[model samples]
Target: MRPPCDPSKFVAEIVKNVPPSGIRRFFDLVSGLEDVISLGVGEPDFITPWHIREMCIHSLEKGQTSYTSNYGLPELRDELSRTYYRRYGLDYDPASEILVTTGVSEAIDIALRAVVNPGDEVIVVQPAYVAYVPAVVLAGGKPVIVSTHRDDEFRLTAEVLKPAITSKTRAIVLNFPNNPTGAIMTREDLEDIADLVAEHDLLVISDEVYECLTYEGKHIPFSSLEGMKERTVMLNGFSKAYAMTGMRLGFAMAAPEIIRSMMMIHQYSMLCAPITAQIGALEALRNGNDEMERMVREYDRRRHFIVRGFNRIGLDCFTPKGAFYAFPYVGATGLSSSEFSERLLNEKRVVAIPGDVFGEAGEGFLRCAYAASMDDLKKAIDRMDEFVGGL
Candidate 1:
């Protein structure tokens, strides 16, 4: 005799509603296909620098394998405090104001859950990362999408953001050098948003994970603005800058009350980030900037290479100011983004994400992440030429 087969009780409605990450789904499909060239993933191609890897090894050797404090190891928190002020001009008391999470990815989730109540609204700017909407849904908040225009370089302007606010609005998620589009917000843009948040008294989740990868100008943390530090939870990590994605560590800085509140949720959801990874990230914060500079310089070179190649090949692409993606307008191809992407991959073996994955506004574009090798990028460009020529 077997127990009753009511496995549906084991599944959550929230998990069922969450679609697979659109970027990763394409990567998986193209994985075993012969002669595939992928520009689809958002991870850096660089290996974690040897010194950071050594520090993790040292931590493990010293029996630093125990679980850290829910908020994270204090020394690492202090290092993050120093690094935050030193790098971004944002000051936070690491002990009371920071909560380390698995990655900025989780930092986004927990912070949103802490702030948003059921039926509250969370404003998401597009074309944004794929995570924000689902996180908002799981937290029982409604997602109010604010479209950012390509003609305006896809920035989240104050003009674009203000009208979307209402009495039920709980928070706004800000990402820059943003994912998919690689557009960054300017200081003026931050000031306007800050003024809005101040007027409406809204919380902010500012994701600046690509702060170290900007090419056109400096990366400005929205939390660094005058009144925003109190209202904004700054989420960032070593993944993009140090090529330490697999290390699975990130930190959030906010008002002490907000941090304390989120910590309770973090304590339950995840005990703490991996002890070994925290050790490596702390070392990266203290000593890895030189390596970061080299990587940014290399990415800058690849940025120019991809943008120029796309322009020469008849794709209308704006120069990305931050992050390692090239969002090129593919409207002239006379195909929808899905059709174009599928045809390109199947015909030319070149992989890129259809921009609609970011949002409906992204329909006429394709996001080609340049975080692959220079040779791979060059090969992708060659394949693009061959594919477009056939059209």
Candidate 2:
């Protein structure tokens, strides 16, 4: 008989330090509760538009069910290339510089794995998406977090970036129209980052999945900077903008050499994104802009409703300029982020993610995703107001 396996031997050392994603726990807990209003998940509540859905069905009916090229279908790549150029004024060779991945999440993973070596240092701005640190660790790198203050709109400045850099630094992971915080980087901010990155020769793994969601200003691609194109790996997707999150279609754009290496990883890891998703993404790029704009406008309206509601209820929320989240300070409640969320959930049936779930910098706050119906938003506000008033 084979010897009994040791449980300790089965788990990797890296897995021990990485905590479970805090975002997922709230999602799982809320999903089981009946009549619970959830603003926990940072996903567009809208359905994939009819035309985009039709494209996927049409492709499936046409027997386009087989695996695509590991780099992705050429048609999708061509359209995505055109879309990026048209929208951001950044030129990328579809054939040599783009690799379609399962989602922007996967693109981030691929980029991290492709560039980072053991003990390499990657600078991450927090409060950020939960995936960045773990992705770095899985790539055999150390994540050096730079805390961005809520008071400053969560902008990651060169001042913060300076101390995080050392000789071991390999890259900086930038996720703007940031998760939880909803902050965006301006052109001036990108220019400053370009100067530092150029001096340090640092690679920028830019996650711009929420590019289309900015409310106050235009989305500026970090890759659009003069000296940044060759150094930036852009991660974009059909999820938030097209409401195609379930389709799991996203792509990465980088220099030819970087794309070649990422393609090799993609070939071994995922092979390719679903052929159906590729088709849907292609149609989304071709025709989904108008739909995206409509949704963005809707989100903007909902954003104001949520923020103004919170203010009226005595919970002062910082109005977000990008993404569909509002980070509100919950200090008056005399509860920690987790405590406040739990109390609100049990007492009011209103579910929102605790900001600390994003990182320590996210403490003293709560993240409310404004991706629900207006009625739902109003109901949630009422519930929260009642709960807070009793405090």
Candidate 3:
């Protein structure tokens, strides 16, 4: 005589222990509403450019729907090898070191599962992507959070990171041009931590999905630093850069042994990234740069406009140098992050995610994505002005 829907009876302990994504919950509130200008999710507003979609269509017309090799399409991996080398001057073998994942999401999951032993400690920097900490917990590792401060421009420094290390610490997850904060770590910023990673012999799981969207500085791959490539599992994806989120393609690069380990989990769990998507991704790498840059330029414009608008409306907003988000301090409204977001939605119909959803360190801020149309951005800003002015 158990209750009808008891979590303890039906769910795994870890599954029950971890709460559902706070971002997802906010999105759910907006789902039934009409004319909502949602800045909640961190997804691009651009469509996959014509050529990438055309390639997917061409694949389907050619009956190319079969499962790809468990590792991924070889040709796609080859193209990725060329792309990374051309951009970062880093070399990863197409055969043994590169893995095309279902998305960067799956890449993270498999990589964590492959490396984490039960109770091993993994460092997750906050305010972090919603996925990182949960992914670590699900992989059987204890997540050790290191909060990055707004005063540091949200950069994680070696001096701040040194005290967090211990013998149980197995790895650290690094995301630059980060979501929520839209913060980027420059080469000097990253080099400081690279030295620490080297000193402690810690592994790095670097998610550089937003690398192409960097505005103020050149993007530097963590693996490019001396003595770090062998210890880093680097992940990048088409979803962010190419605006191909629906296609669900991403790739991971690491040493041969690590690649093999991740591939085993991937084979059993996902088998392969879709064959049609692989063909599309290959086409994207070959010809999508200009279109991608165009989108980035537009985002750059919207970024400035929204940030200025937020500041003018009396919110102290940090100007983000990369990605398409503006993190505005909403404490001026005298509300908790959730309270501010709920009140805004109920009163203004504009959707900015409550920053505490990202992490506890994010409680006083609101993540406003600039990925919306300029018209929407303008109206959202105007509405925000009214909302704050009334308060």
Model 1 ranges with Cα > 4 A deviation: 1-6, 23-28
Overall lDDT per candidate, in order of appearance: 0.91, 0.90, 0.90
Instruction: Give a tens-digit lDDT track for model 1, residues 234-351.
Output: 8999899999999898999999999998999999989899999999988998899899999999999999999999999999999999999999999898989988998999899998
Candidate 2 segments whose C-alpha is farther than 4 A from its true place: 6-8, 24-28
TM-score of every candidate: 0.97, 0.97, 0.97
lDDT pick, better of 1 and 2: 1
lDDT of 3: 0.90
Task: Quote the lDDT for 327 in model 3.
Answer: 94
TM-score of 2: 0.97
> Pick by lDDT: which candidate is best?
1
Shift of residue 286 alpha carbon in model 2, Å: 0.7
lDDT string for model 3 (265-293, tens) is: 99988999998889999998999989999
Cα RMSD to the true fold for all candidates:
1.4, 1.4, 1.7
**Clash number for candidate 1:** 0
Q: How many clashes (backbone atoms < 3 Å, residues ≥3 apart in a chain or on different chains) does model 3 have?
A: 0
